[model samples]
Target: MTISNESDPFYKRLSLNLISIGLIAAALYIAQDILLPLFFSMLLAALLLPAVKFLQRKKIPKIVSIILSLTISLVLVFGILYFLTTQVLNFLDDSDMIEDKFNGLIRDAQRWVSQNFHVGIRKQNQYIHDTAEKIKTSGPALVGQTFLSLTEIFSYLIFIPIYTFLLLYYKDLIKKFLVDSFRNSSEHQVVTILQECQNVSQHYILGLLIEMTIVFSLNAAGFLILGIPYAIFLALVGALLNLIPYVGMLVANIFCMIITLISSPDISNVLWVGVVLMAVQFIDNNFLMPLIVGSKVRINALATIVGVLIGGALCGVPGMFLAIPGVAVLKVIFDRVDGLKAWGTLMGDPGADKQREKLKDAIH
Candidate 1:
């Protein structure tokens, strides 16, 4: 008997799977406004659960514990915000200096263009003027959009905490509901998956927070050593941006380099800034993250990059932020489910797999 690969059941399943993915992607894009806040709150609630439990052990009411946890979190968040705001204000206070430096850079750029490309200063000036005019015409719409986004964020500020509190308070009910919904399935698997999900969420979030702190501290120290202006602000920005995985670090590095070039007298500052950030990143990828975060996810670089890009294309910034954790959760689920082992492997690091194989060899 001859078997044709294209006519196999596998091909039918593949087509169905591809169609399902497309449908899911379209649904996610459509429902992003509702779902983003919900997803974000779920993660936040997971992060807060341990604190809430700890407080409850001290004879505190669950409600009170939740409130306390929320308060502490808010205080920390606002404190950081205040610092950022102050730093930004100080940076803005030097607007005149920045303007002068920017003009010098522009003039130098125009001259270089003229020298190399035979484009005159007049053409450059005219091009810049046209750009500025276009910007002037469209500025109001951009400002309006920014204002609307900020308003939407502020609205979520109210709803997210409420959702988080409800999730925490009804954690057992949610778990029970899930278990009951899967009544036909193995209770053992459901329980295991639920427990693993909680563990992953808690560990991943706590690890991420710790990792960000360490990265920020290292960045700030490096910037301070180099006497960079607005060091704290830049460090915080870089560390936060670095949360998006590989692409984030590149963007953050470029941003810091631009800041250094524009703010400092010497171009050497830009190179030093790059060196410091790169060292910090090297430590982060190799040591700090591995130790603090643990390697439970095991996603490969290719999948990570692809996930981030697809996520960004789907729902912009929040989507990018959600992509890694979302993919990690999917991997965890796929690993537990029958016949999905191939998917788990596809999403995982080949290097990690090899390491596991080598360890098994040694043990045997």
Candidate 2:
């Protein structure tokens, strides 16, 4: 006897699952404002945990260790900000000359576009003029909005360190509390999942730092070789932006090209700047990132991109930066659960699966 579609167990479970997902999506959308800060705090805590552990091993008191770590993090952040601010102020001070240089570069760009795409330079110039006029009209309001954004950023900056410190101080207690609070076969599974999440987070954070350092060094060297002004500032900005995944490289390249154009009106200099950025991206994608961050979290490229897009849609750049690690942690937990194993497989690297299969064959 054939079962009715609605009465079938598989169909019933599928409907329930879809409904559950819809509810979750709704809740997440509603709770996004609160979730953003909490998510950032959690990520900060994960990144700082290894440092906290290192300090603890060195016989530092937990409170002192937390303070030290927070201080170091803040100092680094402020140092970079100071450098960037100085570079920006200097650029503004030279605004007249920079504008002239940029105008020349725009003409060169229009010429290139005309040559390559058969586009009319007159229309391109008019488009550029219109864009400038729009910016002129909206500039003050945009500046005000930017200031408001900076204020919010500073608020989160203050909140994150405090939250991270508390998490580090109470991390063991928190883990114990979780394990003790739940008692059952499920509790053991939960504990295992938590451990896996922690492991993945720690690895991702450490690997990211390593990757950033490589990118920074490579960019700095390239910029300096190309005689790019404010090479240090540009390189630092590019490295930090690189943390945001796929689009970060494009953003960095645009910023670098703009800076180069403003610094030197010569088309050759701007071309060299583009070449440098391309070279850095090529090395980063093919060599540096793979060598440094390879297979650490077992996250696949597509999942990472999708996660970034979803995160950006939800909460902008911060969301984009946090997305992959958040998804990676979830994937780790899902892999340990029989019900979610398929999803875990979907999130994981195909290369990792191949490696596992090869290892299994060798073991047998």
Candidate 3:
């Protein structure tokens, strides 16, 4: 007997799954204001979990352990912020000199363009004037957007730690809730998913931190050796920006080169700056990433790029930052749930699939 289309388990499950994903995406976008802080806090809580557990094991109260962990995290965060602020202030202090140098460069560029492209200096000046007028017209909207961004940043700073503390204090309650919610699945299966998710989140975060530190060191050393002005500040900025994945390093490189050009009259220094950053980037891509971060997630490049692009489209930078860990967690859960093994494979690297196949063959 043939099953009706409506009664067919395969079609029913597929439709339901598609609807569920759509609903999830809608909820994530609609409730991002509330959820972004919570999601960010979840990552922080995961990173601090071991420290909290250790403190509790040492006879500290759960509340006190969480507070201590958050306090330490905040101190570290504030320290970095303070450094960035000081660097920015110093950069601004020399802005007048940079501006003068920039004007000189503009003149040189205008002359070169006039000689080669036959563009008049008057036309170039008029073009610059028109661009300035456009910027002036848009200045008010830009100011308003900047104000909104600052407000959002303040809100995040206020709520993230509070959410993190609550998450840590109620970790067991949350785990219990997750286990209960998956009643159709075995408790062992639910727990295994939770454990793996935590492992992936923690390892991914720790790996990123380690990778950033190494990159910062390498960059700073290289810049110093090359006598690049604002070496430490430029290095720090590049390293921090590198956290954004594929697009970040290229942006960092361009930014550094621009700043170097503005600060130095020697045209050769710009190329040297590029060379130093390129060498560091080469090392990072070849050695540091594979050793520190790549092994943690095991996502294929296609999935990672797509996830990052989708995340950026949906929720901007925070979404992009969370994409890899989020996808890794999803992969773990999918691989464990028999129906989703195919999806897990789709997201995972070829090496991971090979290992899985070998294990299955051995088991058979």
Local distance difference test values of all predictions, in order:
0.86, 0.80, 0.87
> How well is each residue in 6-51 modelled by candidate 3, as lDDT tens digits?
6787777778778987887788788888898998899999999999
In model 1, which regions exceed 4 Å deviation? Answer: 1-8, 353-364
* Least accurate 10 contiguous residues by lDDT in model 1: 352-361
TM-score of each: 0.92, 0.82, 0.91
Q: List the residue pairs that clash in candidate 1.
A: none
Best by lDDT: 3
Show where candidate 3 strays beyond 4 Å: 1-18, 352-364
lDDT measured at residue 327 in model 3 versus the true structure, 0 to 100: 86
lDDT (10s digit) by residue, model 1, range 1-364: 8869767987776787788879989988999888888888888898899999999999999999999998898888789889888988988999899889988998898899999999999988899899999999999999999998998788678888888999999999998998898889777788898887777778888888889999999999999988987899889988989898888999999998997788899889899889989999998887666555545666787888999999999988889988888888878887898757778889888686565455457658
Arranged by TM-score with the best first, the candidates are: 1, 3, 2
Residue 11, model 3: lDDT of 73
Candidate 1 structure lDDT: 0.86
Error of 1 at 187 (Å): 2.6
